[model samples]
Target: MTNFLERLKSPGDLKCLSLGELKQLAAEIRERIVETVSRNGGHLASSLGVVELTIALHRVLETPRDQIVWDVGHQAYAHKLLTGRLDRFDTLRRLNGISGFPRRSESPYDSFGAGHASTSISAALGMAAARDTMGGSEKVVAVIGDGSLTGGLAFEGLNQAGALKKDLIVVLNDNEMSISPNVGALASFLSRKMTSERFVRFRTGTKLLLGRIPRFGPGLLGIVQRAEGSLKGFLTPGKLFEAFGFEYVGPLDGHSLEDLIETLENVKRLKGPVLLHVLTKKGKGYPFAEESPALFHGVGPFDRATGMVKPSRERADTYTTVFGNTLVEMAEKDERIVAITAAMTDGTGLTEFARRFPGRFYDVGIAEQHAVTFAAGLSCRGLRPVVAIYSTFLQRAYDNILSDVCLQNLPIAFALDRGGLVGEDGPTHHGAFDLSFLRPMPNLAFMVPRNEEELRRAMVTAISHDGPFMFRYPRARSEGLPLNGTPEPVPIGRGETLRGGVDGVIFAVGSMIREALAAAERLEMEGIRLGVVDPRFVKPLDRELLVGAARRAALVVTVEENVLQGGFGSAVMELLEEEGLMARMLRIGLPDRYIEHGSRSELHAACGLDADGIARRIRKVVGADTPVACTPRARFTRG
Candidate 1:
């Protein structure tokens, strides 16, 4: 009941607490986590699950010297609290506050930066190798979840770490799920090893039998370990790890503080690569989270007492919902249409699609590279596969997209969701580079939808197109328009002018259209009349239309949600240069630097991409002073 969490300033302070007190600290930590997360909205369940493990590790090891790398870093809230960040914990995920994930630049205790999963092992191994080279003795450990192991990179790190035979400790935190339930062969193997009753009995009996063999029991057991390797392999999950040259140590009780501290102390003294397999509940302390961990995985704010999220008054559907609904509708009409996601069935809004047509749905289990190439394979067999993934995650499969899809000119529909500043997920998840990276690939058509209608139209256009096609939508809600259900194909390389003016023109794309129009409305009050154009396609650049618009206006401005470098604005400038038309131009978008965590509106304002910011920038381009008294028309909301 005492404020133990407030008193503890550093990991060194944890050394003074008794096992009972440490257990108490774990409870307090979980309470604090739930309280903060209920208001702030963050990765809650994972953080709650790892409280004990986090305490145990800090208790047993000397941190800041002994490195602890967390895979994905979403579950390190307890670690953050113990390491001098408790005071700022309230500001988690807010703009300019402490990050939800680990950042090496933010704190020295954070040994490595992580937002995405499955890179912990490699980073820890590298640190271990570096320590060895310098002739130093600081323990290095990587705490990885079972879900993170689903990635190929984790195994790649394991392979190299095993071969190197360096002193490294890997903590495999088995929570039976990632963001969603675990899938694939690795999940099956871990599950089989954990649940086999016969294997558990046999393993226990063999160890007891070996202990009873007089004076020679210990030495003989050690020597014949490999001779009995087959039997042990059949009986334990750790046999696979043993083969990789690691000293396999667990199947431990992760919730028991005494057992965890004791086991970690033992493993800390061992030499060479060691792996301690820990079993923990995904949402341990909280009952509601325990019942449905997936819903609480990366949750929005909720009522702490009832665990119920307040009903949102937003009547509009998000872009993801529209995509999912449209995809199912289209699939009903076209039997050849199939959907794919990389273990993000619910997050990607394919839950309805999966329930309606299970056979046509494929969840690839966090393997984006495989998802893209697999979609290509599906295309080869005359089936149309649409890969719906977050723009940030899709960066992982760029090679496959370029080689297997674009190079081959396959009919794969790439539906990129979360295509702009994803807010609280931060720089790691912001889709700032997709336009720049995706523009150069040959035989690819790029489109950014202005609203729900345009998104549906683009979806239809992408599905019907012969070559590789990409359409991106932001992470916010749609325009709340009534359903038309008709799929109209937008003419390629052409822009539609929404408002006409003689002084200047504003070219807007995707989510920025509403803001651009609002800025134009504000500027009109000051006698600065500006025209607006919606260039639906980013790749084709709409050369003729854009050049003609630029030539007529004294000033031209391009607005997008993407970064300035090699973005839609760059495409517009290059087109103007080609036609030898020189005009005063300004590009309004995200800055070259990585945008930090915040609400989308706050980030938009910070980056000068919001309506007021855009209006000021436009007024500066022309020689018009700010209006003294003006009532701009009702703000332009998307139709």
Candidate 2:
């Protein structure tokens, strides 16, 4: 009912408001988010948690000049409001409104466009180093949540930040949460130290005073540091970060504006790569958010007052749910089955599996690289490791996935969630390149399930089968069939012909499988014999099935939600060339252009990966033979 947020224009206006006014502003912001996101679903919990912190940052730091890089920029809703984007705030994550994360094109204040985690510290340090190199006076700050700290990149940045010892401000927003509750021993230690304000003050003051004084400072500080390390080990946790050469400071209350401001100011003035740990509660102000922060992490449309999420009417089962439920069933049957998620137990559909089998479940917080190696280690021993992760995020650990898992031929099931156009989350979130990247890897078997039944079957086959195996699924729901299928073991490196035809065979991956099937049915109606093949594994090439299909069909069309270059289509083209089958080849996928924010259907239609688009491609290939009523617009726009 109130438009108080509209009244306040800039950070300067926000600065003039008193503490009480700021609290009211927080409420207003939440109200606006609920109103907007309920109508247009976006990240709820993360944005909600950062409200006060966002206000404090704007109030303390000069914007557009002082670069602040937010790690995994989903929680930048408040940051957006304070910037010049409040006017267009109504159209968040729409066709052409505003983005969910920070974008360079969106506004000047957004220092970097980030949807991935564990990048803030590294990126911010880069900006800081550049500023120093150019002899600039702008401040460089990185706001990273605790969950993101699980990422090795953050540690690599921390190590560099410490070694470089440049004036870099790395603020750890310790909400004891980031997507999921902070896990691992390091998270627990940081969280404990965060609440221990008295201890932090004592250690920092001693270090600053002792580390200074020029001549004897190094020797004296060294002795004192060693002494403190031993003394603190008894009183506090081990100092893994201090050894990294960072001036680690408090686990201050992030929610308390006064404390946050005071601590930030204290660290701001300090020089030579300082680390300030600010403790805050995720979904602090709102009760529902406070109670179930994970649910609110990146939420959809919901009933604001009651904090009730709107149930989807589509009734289709998402690929994630299919994977998750299938995993639980497999784990129940076999004791060797274990699951791993990179801080996405809830997102990856492993929550039920986690609940059912606590010991087997491993939620490696925001650390894709670690999750891969960890799974590899599990595989080395006799245990089956299933690393379930989003496609885009999984790319962060490409080297690890290739070298550790694939090269070694570890029997790990990579359940790729949101494998295609993820919709609204934009280019950063889309798992578009999985098929292309994974297809080339050695000892790897990749599959894309058309429906819930295949998704379950793939997981079941992966669990029992040896060597590295992966299967991708979409962000949308399942086939509403409750994963009904005979538990048929997946024939590795084999393609199944969904519909038989002599005209052409459409080889589609994951989400495209459904569309390819639909296209087959459409052609069938017109008395055109079109064949559909769901190539279960990409790496192996399904030689027997594919060769037989190609021999019979006049054309081979490969459909995937990835780039044409080095993508599934590229693989198919390579295979055809190798086999000496110069049949007409058609590729369908996301364009070369970086996809913008839009709904799933909108993005699919635009990219021409939908059923209609798939059919058009099929028609183009087979249409050449017969007079099919169609006009050919370039279905794919090259990047």
Maximum-lDDT candidate:
1
Name the best candidate (by TM-score): 1
* Model 2 CA lDDT for position 584: 64
* Whole-model Cα lDDT of every candidate shown, in order: 0.86, 0.80
Minimum summed lDDT over a 10-residue window in model 2 is located at 627-636
What does the lDDT read for residue 101 in candidate 2? 94
TM-score of each model, in listed order = 0.90, 0.87
- lDDT for each residue of candidate 2 in 1-639, tens digit (9 for 90 to 100): 445578876777876777778778888887777677777888877887888788888877877788889999988988898787888988999998899999988989899989999999999999988998899988889999888888889999999999999898887887763322233233334434443556567877877887787888778889976775665444322366677787666555566676666556556666688776666777776788889989888888888778899899987766787777778877888899889998999999989999999999999888888899999999999999999999898898899989999889889988889888888888899888887777778888887777888778787788878888888888997778754544788778777778777667788877778888888888888876778888776777788787667666667778888888788888776666666665566788878878888998999888888888888766665656652221222443334
User: C-alpha displacement of 222 in model 2, angstroms?
Assistant: 8.6
Question: In candidate 1, what are the lDDT values of residues 1-639, reduced to their tens digit?
Answer: 678898997899989998889888999999999999999899998999999999999988999999999999999999999999998999999989999999988899999999888899999999999998899999999999988887878988999999999999999998883322232233334433533455547766777788789998787777666665654455447788987888776566678787677667767766789898877898799998999788889888999999997565788998999999999999999999999998788888999999999999999877888899999999999999999999999998989999999999999999999999999989999998899899989999999989999999998888888989999999898889997747888765566888888778999999999999999999999988899999889988788777777777878899999999999999887777656566578899889899999999999999999999999888876765322221222442334
